[model samples]
Target chain A: MAPLEPWEKVLISADFTQSIHGRAGCVACHRGQQSPDKDTAHVGLIPDPSQDAQRVCGVCHGEIVDGFGTSLHASLQGYRTIVYSRSVPENHPALDTAMQNHCLSCHTTCGDCHISQPKPVGGGLLNGHNVEKTPSMTRVCTACHGSRVGAEYLGKHEGIPGDVHFREGRMNCMACHAGTDLHAAEGDAAKHRYWGDQQPACKDCHAQVGRADDPIPQHTIHGNKLACQVCHAVEYTSCDGCHVAISEKTGNPFFKTEATYLSFVIGHNPWPSRERPYEYVVLRHAPVAPTTFEYYGENLLPNFGLLPTWTYATPHNIQRQTPQNRSCNTCHGNAALFLTADKVKSEELEANRRVIVENIPAAIPIP
Target chain B: MRRVGMLLLILGVGVFLGACASQGISTPTPVPTAPLPEAVLTPLSQTDYCVQCHTDKEALIETAKPEEKAPSESEGVG
Candidate 1:
């Protein structure tokens, strides 16, 4: 995305001036002087007042602001869960510093969604200071999630079509992910996005699935045995061996991935629960290795094998009919489509032992 | 010739009056009202200097500087 012009960043519109938020006056949110002089007016200016959402937005939106502290978007607890599992308490300080430099920038505030683009994308006002109830899918939501989720949903990969929901239904992220889910309540203790009940499950809308008298024979036989993505999802991105370091020359943090390619691999469910109760689910290779945070200190992730490198995945690229579901033989007896012992790296084989399919299902017998 | 000149002058006056009527230009009418106490006039009710300047397109363009690149890094696994 091209960066916005200087004027475009600060320009205010007439519609905003008459809005309920705008009527509160600039100083009500942004604590700045009302003087005509530019320097005098900018004294003690708060560029993003919503950074302190408790005091600023809480006046009107107290309910949301109260629970926002625990939200994944604000707390970034999911990252900590994985990072802590891989490191000892002694190495926390160094790991924290690395995260602060490289990962903390992804943290979002209220203004990041409603008023401006995300900080990662060089935030500018989405619509001349007007507050958007539903953030722009292209500008705000996809700005950070663009690398994999955005690409898969929008079909950026060559020869791959976009998700059927996006291509056919024109449903944006908000269509499935509700605002309440994004602003997860204070007591909600789910560590990872996939840990709890599916926020937007397939069965929520498609109630007809798994019915006894269903028309499709596969629906009855395979519904409980496989995750919907195992058959519905097509090839999606899987990254490997991502390393992060601070540049000595420029003193800026950056990350490099060893490889990123499209693949479709079904493996045993690593985190099977009531919500995701299936023997088989799609897997994607995450961009993490033993030395992922080595820049901070030596062997920061000593227990890296505590978690699998090829984690369970729910790819965004869904299709009504995929190559895997064309017929029983398309996936059955097809060892190439399954993550087996030979498919994994030598070092990671131990970590991913739980997910690797030991016995690929045999081909169906002929009549 | 004198009669023709008289008719032209009358037509000009009629056209001028019609244009003014079309534009809804009428004499101002005064309505009486009591002045409110000074305490009722709050700062929130008025458009402050900040809004006055920011809404002005010309003023913003004149003051805005070239955008500086925001420091960024590659995508991390989430």
Candidate 2:
């Protein structure tokens, strides 16, 4: 991480005319003590005012705040499903402690995405806490999401160029992923984030891709049978294994994920939808090892194999012409490009059985 | 040997003079230089009060990084 810019450097530098937060007094949201004395004023000051936005921001922007509460950003139910599925009961003392101390820290609050740098990035004011309708991409989104998605989107990993949309069109994340999508959540508790209809789809913006007149024959031929990312996306970094456990030395919980490697594969879609009723989608190996939470207890997750280790993923490193699109042989005869048993770890074979494509078709040129 | 000693003495004297000249120990003309501007610390946010305490928090985080945490006991176990 780079040294933060001196406060003096950004102070009174940027325009705050349009900033909603600029008008609101700091003490209004961050209630503590306010005095000239450092300790007196700082005591009990909310470092992240967004965490308690229900009480703080809701008073002013009721409907927006209400929508934000159930939003995927707030509830993080999708992440909860993944964690709880592989660990002891959510209420387990050790699990609860870790969730509060470590895991939940990654949880986004309003200020995280809007005003200050995310806590994960060592929180500080971005542009003197000048609130924007579209927050700073590096300070806000990439601060937390930097490991994989950020790297792919920004072309920072493995010398890969940025996503074509961003590189060529100069479009930002908010262009496709609407504010409504980030601030709203609809459906039942059982609904995994993938099941949500509001989830961003390529067809939502690029409706021409799979249309009858589209130049790419593969698009119509494959249709919903293949996800857009599978062909259009370049190789992306993937984390093979992860382990979360309490450190014996410090007794404080720690999280570790395996070394990153770049690979792309087409696998069975975990959850199919109307827009993306794909039989095969891009699969990025997750950071979840079989023994991710075993330190908490023995056999905490008896059915670790219930879900594939290679889950459906949307690598944002999109390109108009990927290796797959160049020639039929890139994918047709390439068993390596498909999630097969041999490609996965021996332990994960069972979990990934459904996703593994047994035989790849021989290269056949399109006339 | 006497000639070599004389040469060495002269070389040493020359080197010392060169070193002094490089270091600006002696100048033909002493130019009065203006003092460099000092940095003024300004608040990046309206909440300068908040930053005062948070600066300590940043220092604490930096210290925490060097402290090694134990790796999980059950890693890579079947």
Give the top-scoring candidate (lDDT): 1
- CA lDDT, candidate 1, residue A105: 83
**Candidate 1 per-residue C-alpha lDDT over A1-367 given as tens digits, one digit per residue, 9 for 90 to 100:** 7888877888889899888999888988998898888779999999999999988998999999898887889888888888888889999999999888877888889999999999888888999899999999989898888878999999989999999999999999999988998877333244777787788888888878889767788989887899999989999999998888987767788888888889999999988888789999999998889998988899998888888888889899999899999989889999999999999999999899999998999988767
Give me the candidate number with maximum TM-score.
1
True contacts kept of each: 0.65, 0.07
Whole-model lDDT for model 2 versus the true structure? 0.72
Overall local distance difference test of candidate 1: 0.88
**Model 2 — TM-score against the truth?**
0.77
Residue pairs in candidate 2 whose N, alpha carbon or C atoms collide under 3 angstroms: none
Docking class of 2: incorrect
RMSD of 2: 21.1
Please list the C-alpha lDDT of all candidates, in the order they appear: 0.88, 0.72
TM-score of every model versus the real structure: 0.88, 0.77
Predicted candidate 2 versus true structure: per-residue lDDT over A1-367, tens digit per residue:
4636444222322345225665455567777775656557767777677788878768877788988867767877776687666655643666565556556767778777777677666666676667656877776787778878788898887578899988998887887877878887777422356765736878777789879888978888887788888889999878766777766676766666666688878888876767458888888887777666667656656667888888878898999888887887888888878887788899989888888888766788767
Clashes of each: 0, 0
TM-score of chain B of each: 0.31, 0.31
